[model samples]
Target: MTLLKTPLLDTIREPADVRRLPQEKLAQLAAELRAETIDAVSVTGGHLGAGLGVVELTVALHHVFNTPHDRLIWDVGHQCYPHKILTGRRERIRTLRTGGGLSGFTNRAESEYDPFGAGHSSTSISAGLGMAVARDLGGGERNVVAVIGDGAMSAGMAYEAMNNAGAMDSRLIVILNDNDMSIAPPTGAMSAYLARLISGQTYRSLREIGKQIAGHLPKFVERGAQRAEEFARGFWTGGTLFEELGFYYVGPIDGHNLDHLLPVLKNVRDAKTGPILVHVVTQKGKGYGPAEQSADKYHGVVKFDVVTGAQVKAKSNAPSYTRVFAESLISEARRDPKIVAITAAMPSGTGIDLFGQAYPDRTFDVGIAEQHAVTFAGGLAAEGFKPFCALYSTFLQRAYDQVIHDVALQGLPVRFIVDRAGLVGADGATHAGAYDLAYLGCLPGMVLMSPADEAELMHMIATAVAYDDGPSAVRFPRGEGVGVERPDRAEALPIGKGRMVRGTGEGDVAILSLGTRLAAALEAAERLEAAGFAVTVADARFAKPIDRDLALKLASGHSALVTVEEGSIGGFGSQVLQFLTDEGVLDRGTVKVRSMVLPDIYIDHDTQARQIAEAGLDANAIVAKVEGLLGKAKAGRELSRAG
Candidate 1:
């Protein structure tokens, strides 16, 4: 209950309360809201910079429009923390991103104010257009506003939605929250004044007349008129790009100013003709001193000191998996000049930033556009260069088509380094890398490997670089390594082969682990041995192109074989099952097989250990499955004796 003195914000329970106040008080409300947001996130440790950027914009939207009725769709939802506070969740603002607390992103079920849940980027325009279309079909006359970021705008989906919305002539409001990816300072008072001037009644009337004239005129005449309009808008407001896309482009206004936001938003809300884009320029970290000074550092923060605005960094004993990947890539690049790295707007997250330092020319940050990054890497691979397309497993879903058609189908030698390949805490299901195993494993000519540890990851990276036959991928989970000493030089491993961690024992139980779950598998083996049954543990290095020889051997040596992976169903386990069936191993009748994968349900934000335990892939769960199999064998022996 760390309460801040938010006198203006304390009076508000919902956005309706915000509207009830006079226009003069709205500015004060915005200031108070910003302070309250800072205080709340200082306690909760969620997204701060984005919410701070949109303080006045949030205030203006709620003030000008009748929300809930006027569907305000927030794309990507990271900026919705302030929106949540204004829309009746202020009391729970401090509980953000915690277990059983308010989500980091918006959820429809969480509140009516949140019209649509957002996690994946560049979806707001499409969803807002849909809402507008739905409204046209007897829903209501309410306005639909979609607030999207500059980083999100880099995604092609946003352009697609705008193109469609323009053609459909849907009455939708798209607010391009131009934080500029924290690259430069936001728009100043001149831009704000220009926005206000264009949103006036005279400009609206003239624009309507010009549109009518262009519609009736000949093709040549219409082209001339359209060019004139584009030139006029572009020269005045710098919006030729949006004008061509069919949206009535309106601003590059300062988003932090309530005066600029209120007038333009009110005008757009009142005047309805076609799709409108309000290009509001906002700083990522607008008000707070620490945030404004270092937007990226404060963009996503840990719990920190409020007065000094210093963040708490917990010291770790081991290096993060990201650093290991970066260092390994650098080592590989030093020897091979043909190797290159690509990231989709997550240089730091993918460890490509570190790679960029050593080999700046070889590193390409494609900027928030995953689909382009994949195909771009595919193009690079086609030219006989080793192109590593490093993306988070969840984000890679955006570029699945490119992986299949452009890379795999074409038999290009693209290397995919799928990072954060397991349930991630705090960010929850939205960013979890749970399904890459199933998705990428099924593709033809795709070589899929999962590293058992950091050292294994280095080895896998080398393997991917060495393999020039077709596309190769290595999925590794989030967080630090298991304290394994990394090799100075990584050697390539044989494709489709697995190594035995524990030698085969006399007992009828075996555990085969995939990815980083090898440690758990070994622990389970130890527990089984302690329980009077000898057990063996093996690491299946590759999910696709599985080690058929090793698999068959494991199956033959044991009466029961259990496969474990930190992935959803129909992945490594399914592949193993299919292979065993094809080989007639299941028909032997003496052996039983069980697969332990993540549950069918989407596990939410929790510690990785807890998530593994809940999915029944932990050491205890493995031991239980083994004991059950052993008991079944004992029962069968008694039945055979009776016979």
Candidate 2:
């Protein structure tokens, strides 16, 4: 791959450098920065389209504002690659999403420029408002700007923060990056001129002077003047909603034009308005031909050919857990017309796109609102329709209240197909599906399950659909499954029952596994057997209402018991220990018990194999654990003989 020359970008070391450059050179700098961003993401596959769209906007913001001092927050942070390059991180830009490298999103610890960390969307307004209030209380004057995508506005949190900020009249600047042409109409020279004119100090000062004079006049006349001013501007600029919320609204200006951005931003910075919103219109994948042609296809990519725009994907022997779930649901929906699918602004991520292709009328994409998605599922369930709420495990945390209050508490038969159940490779700790087991298992009457492979995933889906008594969830990991033969026809398994995968007879040690960790447990069992220690491997299919018979039998029959799961501490293993203690299985101290789960610390982004090994949930880790346990047991026997 030929490296693109960044003669202009190579000169800058910080935002101050960007600010010092001549305004004529800034357009060239933006072009260089855009090329650099593309090259970096091509090396380390990550969010491409978002960063490309905001290249000029990023350069303009840094050039106009004194960053690290002036607070600049990027909502969702996927678009921060360009921002990162300007903020002393250009050297490490190529290492994005890899271990010990720059994060895919804005991180506070990563740099001073990233004042607030973000992985989720629709949070910048709230964080920016808090920073703005803090600056006011400290009697300091630092501009607070939040750049949020139009898609993020679909979430309720953005509006909630906007309402509060509007009421408080805090000096906050919100830049709505409208890339999809959804929020507002197209931008032109007229809109750009109006934005510059309205945002200028002169216009704002005159408006404020008119407000004071109106206050002194008759109440009816003052109201009429205010209405007339709003009507005139709102008719042309379409900013009445923001004006009504107590913010001075500007733009729908061209985000790609540095000329327009620099002047308008300078005006807003100088103005003393309490809260202001700037609407900047730009295209996703603005400069790149491949990305511009199909923005969504290139939104997130693997290591791709920079020129050809062809992504390189690893060949997989088995299908992805996501695909299996989508297919299973599609098959079941065919037979059961009542079955419907729902996603929270992630139709493709949650595999709802495939289902939508099959059954468009039955599939619903509820836009970045997880809380609403859960309750909406509950409403459907109440009406005798089976709603399969498909969401990633990490995202499910956002709708816990709805899950409990509306679905679980009322015993609504909402089947939650929780995708990405374990450590996600490149996305890191923020996206890891590590807490779903702990969170969902504790709920009363919630039937929570995890699949061991692609085959089990199908059965679990079938089981979730069949079990209509209450809310049930099945979490499976990201990436391809363990190449197991999928069932010809998936059949629903009996609830709360475990099947022995290996070693039915009595053994020196027993391994009880849940979820995809079953594969590791079986491998460890083989090693244990080879080392002359009898080992039993059992797959506990359900986390909640664990198979008590299997738990008790394993505890009593083996000298040592080890539980494995790809989740946090207080999950499947915790439930098993609690059940054993209540059953008087642990009172005698005859059996040694150990629960293996993810480490307490958050594991950074790396390959999933490395992450599991680091968490001590891999086969080698399991084998070492068994050897240590059996060694202690043998020593105890020796002490007994000696005594």
* Top-scoring candidate (TM-score): 2
Model 1 CA deviation exceeding 4 Å by range: 181-190, 210-226, 632-643
| Whole-model Cα lDDT of every candidate shown, in order | 0.88, 0.91
Can you write out model 1's per-residue Cα lDDT over 1-643, one digit (the tens) per residue?
A: 4466778888899999999999999988888889888898988797899999999999999999898889999999989988999999988888888877888999987999999988899999999999999999975799999999999999999999999998986799999998865422336777777787777777889877888978998999998987876787688677788878988888888787887788888888887688989988888888888999998788889899889998887788778888888899899999999999999988988999999999999999988899999999999998889999999999999999989999999999999999999888788889999999999999989999999888999999999989999999999989988898888889999999999989653357778899889988888877666655667888999998999988888898888899999998989999999999998999978689999988899877666777778888888898888878776344456668899
List the pairs of residues colliding in candidate 1: none
The TM-score, computed over Cα atoms with residue i paired to residue i, of candidate 2 is 0.97
How do the residues 1-643 of candidate 2 rate in per-residue lDDT, one tens digit apiece?
2178888889999999999999999999999999999998999999999999999999999999999899999999989999999999999998899989999989988999999999889999999999999999999999999999989989999989999999996799999998984466646788788889988888888998999999999999999999999999898788898778777899879999888899999998887768899989889998999999999888999999988999999998999999999999999998999999999989989899999999999999999999999999999999999999999999999999999999999999999989989899889988999999999999999999999989999999999889999999999999999999998889999999988989974779999999999988988887777666788999999998899999988998999999999999899999999999998889999999999999999998988998999899999999989888887344456568899
Q: Each model's TM-score? A: 0.95, 0.97
- Which candidate ranks first by lDDT, i.e. highest? 2
User: Any residue pairs clashing in model 2, and if so which?
Assistant: none
